[model samples]
Target: MSRIILLIAKFSAFMLFVAQVESNCPSKCDCNPYSWDMNQIDLDCHRAQLDTIPRNVPLTTAKADFSLNKLGLDPGFQLKLDHLHDLRNLDLSANFLESTHIKDIPDSVEILDLSANSLSELSLDDLPTNIRELNLAKNGIDSINGCSGESSIQSSSQIAIRFDYNAIPILTRDTFGNCSASFGYIDLSSNNLHTVEHNAFRGVIQKANDSLVIDMSYNKLEIVPFEAFQDAIFDMRGFEYFSLDLRKNPLLCSCNMSWIPMMLDYFQKMGLKGVIMGTCYGPEESAGRHLEELTKAEFKSCTEYSWLKAEIKARTEQRIMPFWQVCLVVLACPGLVATVVLIVGVRMHVKDYRRYRDYVVRKKRQIATQRRRHHFRASGAVGDVLLNSSIKNSQK
Candidate 1:
């Protein structure tokens, strides 16, 4: 019957797929086909000390784990693996890779782990077009703009890029420039971050679709980039999805950060998931205080420059000199500079005057010399006229 023939055909196809999976897998790797979809396979080759990628992987491999190995450190490391047309997941962590090593990952890769390596550059153009989950933790990343180039290539997929435990110094407004829509989940924890400029999250939050959870904990951040998250300066409304974690930072929650409490209160009322925690690092009395614990009346004297004043005060207090003494030096510095400038100006004027005086002396001496010569010439002309008169008298 027709139904019997169809069943036989299905059985034959299943057997052929099983044979392919059994014969094509590398000897060191454990390869198996999915129970539901027999054609798709998973290859686990981790901890195998693989210096070279095995060319014997199944053509239907959907996931491959080649982590914990000193794989070939070439930009074209995976170029010849085109047989894995359905390869989606790849883990190459702990391979000590740089940006060049991952420049040519397969376009089919959706999840990639290049963590625990030595990557420094943060360009996303090296990523696969379909990358959704990218892990770059424990690297030496010192720059950003990862989402700034060809960023629309991953627009179809939500992003979860991790840059934890790096040496990233600062975050500017253009850090995530041109990021795709619905892009979210950036981890910047445990970095050498010193500052986050205002509107720093504008690039990543411009096209936020649902939730934007940023982990900026464990840095030297003195203040949050509040404008990009709460203020009307960027029209950042709909606060149900914006979650910022600022714990463990040496935050200077002073007057300028008076706006921090207001932002927390607004986000809380507007469906905040959890508490947005920020602790103070200075101002003597507020050193161990939390931003939420501050009374509203405490900020009566707070201004836009209050945090700056606190920073300056804190910096000056740390020096060997007293605050007033440092202020004296700072205030008297300009006067010292002015005195030097004045002295230099007086010396220049004195030098110019002396040069002019010498020139005048030389001119006077030249004039005296010319007057003597003119008197002598006049005397000589008189003598010549007298001689001519005497000659005429003698001739007469």
Candidate 2:
């Protein structure tokens, strides 16, 4: 009988603990078992017409879905989720978040869905560095904030960034400069992209084991800039999965379109996969034609006059210098040589003349000294003869 009472008390204590967990769950949110074991709870408040995150989102929530709601993000609204440190997934998509200047996003969130929002701008401060998959699709974003060489989106893990369906006109190298993260894939398709500047994919491409997929289809692309690949396309040896989707674009077919076949030939030789060579949509005669089908002769006609001009220009560049200029240079060479030779000869003559003048001065001094010595000796001999005559006269 004592054993039965003890068992009854333990059952009552277990019920009290379960009641406390249930009370922690929000009243409006439909909290359900996370799995068959019922060990955790998954809070789902999707389409709940929530103006703000539930004031009491249970700290035990693993995944929170707040999508398809009328939540407007601004500086005034507090979006703090400090309590939910283990929250891995946060879905706030389709919420009329015009401004992405959000704060207090849980650092633990790996997948953040901000798609279908009214976001017009994005910056480093607007997102968390720990985010692995960021969805900014179907927004009014016109430009991406450059990193100014600070940090990249690439962290210890692979990151996938989606920017499809935006008003981006030109994609310069600095567009993704801040995305220091090696990207899994960067979807820029369906944007009003008219120009992709040289090496536009510079910092975004991950140099990891998995290949990077860049989607630029269904846009206003006329030419695939050669510099965009940074010449890495030639050495696609080790990449596990490298693919480029450039279909549905209004590519202008011209002589420059020759590069399309060259790239296709390269992909075939290397056994690389996932290359969709889009067709040409211009030059009236070659519209709706695939880039691979068009031969060199067919492409050259697009710029018929350009060939003649190019040939002439090439011939002109290869041509020798003008006859008069050649003659002038030749003549000037000899004149320069003659001038140098004349200067050297004049210097030698001046040196020799100075030496001769010094020699003549020395010879004149020696001759003058010899005449004085001879005069002295002759006078001394005459004085000796007179002295002898005076002595002989005194003796007589």
Overall lDDT per candidate, in order of appearance? 0.72, 0.70
lDDT of 2 by residue, 1-396 (tens): 999998898777656645665778776678765543334557888978787877888777778888998777544565667788778788889887765334567777788888998888777545666778888899898877756666624366767889899888888775655456666678988999898887677666545355777888889999876557643443344457766777899898766565555455445544566364678888788899876676545544445335433433443444446668989999999999999999999999999999999999878766765555555556687755754554454445
lDDT of 1 by residue, 65-146 (tens): 8899877555545535656779889998888667777766788888999898778877766677788888999988898764
Estimate TM-scores for all models.
0.68, 0.64
- Which residue ranges in model 2 land beyond 4 Å of their true spot? 1-21, 35-40, 73-75, 152-154, 231-237, 292-396
- How many angstroms is residue 231 displaced in model 1 relative to the true structure, after the best TM-score fit? 8.2
Off by over 4 Å in 1: 1-15, 73-83, 148-150, 206-209, 228-236, 269-274, 305-396
For candidate 2, the 10 contiguous residues with the lowest summed lDDT are 304-313
